[model samples]
Target: MSLFQLQFIHRHRIVRLDDVPPQRTLLEVLREDLQACDAKEGCNEGDCGACTVVIGEPRDDGIHYKAINGCIRMAHSVHGMAIWTAQDLTQADGTPHPVQAALRDHHATQCGFCTPGFAMSLFALYQNKVCPQQAITPETAQHYLSGNLCRCTGYRPLVDAACSLNDSPVVTPDDVTLRTQLSKIEPRGLSNDNPYLQPHTLAQLLHLRRIYPQAQLIAGGTDVGLWVTKQHKQWLRIIDVTQVRELQNIDTQTTHVRIGAAVTLEQAWATLACERPELKRFWHRFAGLPVRNSGTLGGNIANGSPIGDSMPLLIALHADVVLAREEAGQVVERTMPLEHLYTGYRQNCLLQGEVLAYIDVPRPSANEWLRVYKISKRQEDDISAVCLAIQLKRDAQGVVLDASIGVGGVAATPVRAHQTQACLQGFAWDEARVKVAQQQLQQEFTPVSDMRASASYRSQVLVNLLQRAWYESQDMRCITLETLA
Candidate 1:
């Protein structure tokens, strides 16, 4: 039984590219399948910049766009979106767009393998030309391009190339008629009319779960797609949750913000940016624009990576995970704290038949201050050596009302330092209080040593991050990289 056919929808229209296999990666499709060879495959696992491409997706709030590593993205993943490669940046008259023109004028290209990836990454920035809601400063420019590695041209010229695209016209169909030409490509075919469950409603999703109990449930394929592309493994039976409409909504009522499991990080961040501007900074550094565009809050939560950055913040915010399962032909939903959602390393409490449906974060009061900090070897596009998120509330008299601290990269799962939180409660937050809290963090966990950082370094960074949180809560200005030199 065929539940539905998989189609690669691009720019509000389906792209029908002939001779491409269903499980092929977007990088391979751009390079080999579609013959658009600019997006190279430097590191097949999404580390290098050679395979960068900007995908244009129509989001509910706005046009959600980001530069994703084409090397790891599956062809079917580009459905219902418009993809722009570096090859699309020039005008019909053969004039280069500002981003390309700037790169050329600045002599940004060296080996040129990384150039196309950088061009596409910058092109994504160029398309969204207006000043971002969170200003794209030099720090952010570095963060955005961190996932793309260039061995030559030192990165200054590339960064300059990005900054110069600020005045360029938007890269949309209106500007270049790019969509009309892109629509000419043919669609890739899925394996043998095999049933692909696309549940649009909560009731339907559950019903299908029972119907296909053995079907593999998929959300964002940041992790699972590797099973196909990198691992060369295929799921004979799989049900993608991306098409489930109910699971993709982000609802904010008077008391809480409910983010559906299928909601992309791009969507969730925008929703949270209004309420928590501080979170915008972490969201920018969460992943490159592309990974953020497709990766989801639910998927990240369900992934159960101990070093994952999002879980620590969600844990600190007292967020809840909602799980949906099929029971005797009916859909049942259950809710629990985000921390309890995991069991151990590479393991989660989720049932075999259940899918994470949504996450709910209680709205913070006006006096409550929340901050999240990720300490990694690199500023962006890297896993955390120690991920810390803190939520603090104080009364008018400067007495601590309540406090919650969550730390990752220190244990089997993202965990809250309840004991540390207890030590800070009711204590006057002076230098003395900071010292005690910092010392308590050292006692919180014995972080495992890894290549990104040593256990001692991770421990120290956690303490430093908490102290920084203390200052940030006070709106105190501190020295940053820009101020150092």
Candidate 2:
């Protein structure tokens, strides 16, 4: 198929387009071409959920409804899937959807700017949770609505609207027809003439990587979208990683979990957090549900954002990355520690034609005590000034045996604190030793001053966080923001 040609299901009907730009975003198509302004363009970046939309990905089991930022979603990425905009929620007979009714009855919307996005996010949650009779709590509602921002409404009404779904039940339209139609779509490859290349298999992906050496690879578009929307940059070619088949699997083994490159952060973090119960809070703090649903964990690692939350946690977990390429009709794979993947700021050692295929994360041992801290201005839906993940093992006599420390937002790339780890090793795991090591931790990195934080503040927070970890290690109660939540 021609790369410019696009086809998908919209509002229970098939839609097709020709000569669509290779990098045209879904929001641009909806607002500019179709005049569907329900998904408004606010930030254009993924942060503000004003352009939230629910996409239905048809799987063998059923249709997986995901809420994603439409502003940043490339139109080519949604070629085979079904899209649900906020305007499509009304029933055929003009009956408002239960979600819409609940929001109206509760007066959850004020100024009406963010209401559609909230409704779309709630629609995704309703289809996934309400259809299966899952109990939806206020926490669940809050989690789903994290991406949405309302300047007027205090959010109590919105939370109440989400929580009230089960109280007043309504019938959901049957999706058997939609399901049958979408499931029949056989995956197709974009033409070589196509600037946006989507390959279904890892081998094909690698082959295309070699052919299009200058083509930027995009998985979730969380990072690349910003360059287009904010920086106003355009690329002649883009290689989409989401369609690659083997890159979407998550295989759990006896000791560790292998996450594919296209696995969304929501699914990947949940799977990884299953083994480590302590990771639940940390993973939830990664982003709002919509961003998490669309963004991929492997993409985050491949992005090598110095302030990325996953790298520090993965580095502490002793994760390894499998870089692969197609050679002689066979896959050539090389494994390296996750921290070693990045060489400098926003730079990775991935050679041309070599793509990051899998991330192998080892499970934490029983002897290890893991502590993850994200210091940001806001409690949630914010970027981190300093993200720290510490894992320690100590002897029965309370002497430190080994230590693993990974930190972000203080280095050019996500880095492991080798000197800090060494300082903590072979010493008594107590207040006095922790105090001594705190100075070393602060001196390990020269953090640059930015809008988020000053270099001095980042250093002092590292020391304070280490002290907090020590205080808790001694069985003393240390109150955290999450503890209050």
Candidate 3:
């Protein structure tokens, strides 16, 4: 097959490069190919904000510019998008942008290695928040900047710079023209023998999956990018499934919310949090904003990581997944409870040529009370050492009607705490019953020790999580991150 190039708008200039590899990082194209060197590669993972850049995707609402770690984002995945780096903020006359001026005035830059990433993140905040005339509170600023890290200088000055975005005159690029150009942007064509395939429709994606069953599938590339940068693995062929139209819809029905497979975690989290507001804190702790914007809920569940935060939450809510495959030139689909999908550590029961299509999350009922907890080293952008999600329905008399518990970081797979649920089923929703069930919850799984925590620590945290839920049920204030808000 012939080789293809990437075409997109870098800053205000249209850029086209020849024969770039499909799995190449956007950071590679920015620094090596286009020579837009403002974004520096720091962690080479999504954790550090050093390689942050804003990519504008034209949506039905408007152009949504989100901060993403260019070091982990796929180059070809940004076929015809608009990318803005730190250097793109300055004008021809050398007048600094509001974000740059804020950082400089606040003395947020020290050593300057992470400055570009911080500046780009602030630039995104300015565009999405200040430019749109929305409020950028200190809490909002801190939440948006959670993905960025600066070892030399502390976050006080960075927070100051972020909170200061609205004070200055908002001088942003003309997005009207950019949105029009984005509407005209087309998906990059595939070469005859190309290892990279971009499919725009579900039929095309399903047929391609049937033809190339061995092909690796990538939506956000958050996990697969680590395989390349960290583990140094290479793929011969990859099917890009982000463009599938059917896999991007989120339908809010009467009793359930059907989230498409390719829906970004940010969108899904926002939708789910609206249904159950108690999950807002836990959802924000999943990862940094860039990871949330790029990664998908379906991708997280499909990966079947034992420590993934989403699985336990879904299992507790009694969610189901829809898997689709092209069989004998026909499209076939099947749905199963989410807890039954996992087979082993990082393994799932998805059949060959099948792809996860949608996740049906049930809405909370009137008598339902749910609580989720994540015990991690850091409150933000950190993996859970022990994660717990419990949903129980109770009558007005405080009798436990039904109970479902989902837990992670304490088992080979995200297991449902069936024994504990049974213990709590007919019991009164009181401290005595919860105390007894907490002991059963610990015995439900024998956790393994890793760098995050010891086996004993994982086992003990479950008891405390349940205790906190007990306190929350009684409407008493506890030590929670939400109080900070």
Clashes of 1: 11
Q: Give the residue spans of candidate 1 off by over 4 A.
A: 1-22, 58-65, 130-146, 166-198, 471-477, 482-485
Q: Which candidate ranks first by TM-score, i.e. highest?
A: 2
Full-model lDDT for every candidate: 0.75, 0.88, 0.88
Write candidate 3's Cα lDDT for 233-322 as tens digits.
777778888889999999989989999989999999999999899998888889998898899998999888889999999999999999
Evaluated at residue 92, the lDDT of candidate 3 is: 73
Per-model TM against the reference: 0.85, 0.97, 0.97
The TM-score of candidate 2 is 0.97
RMSD after CA superposition, every candidate: 4.0, 1.4, 1.6
lDDT digits (tens) for residues 295-319 of candidate 1: 7888888888999988998888899
lDDT of 3 at 310: 95
For residue 382, model 3's alpha carbon misses the true position, in angstroms, by 0.8
Work out candidate 2's RMSD over C-alphas. Answer: 1.4
C-alpha RMSD (angstroms) for model 1: 4.0
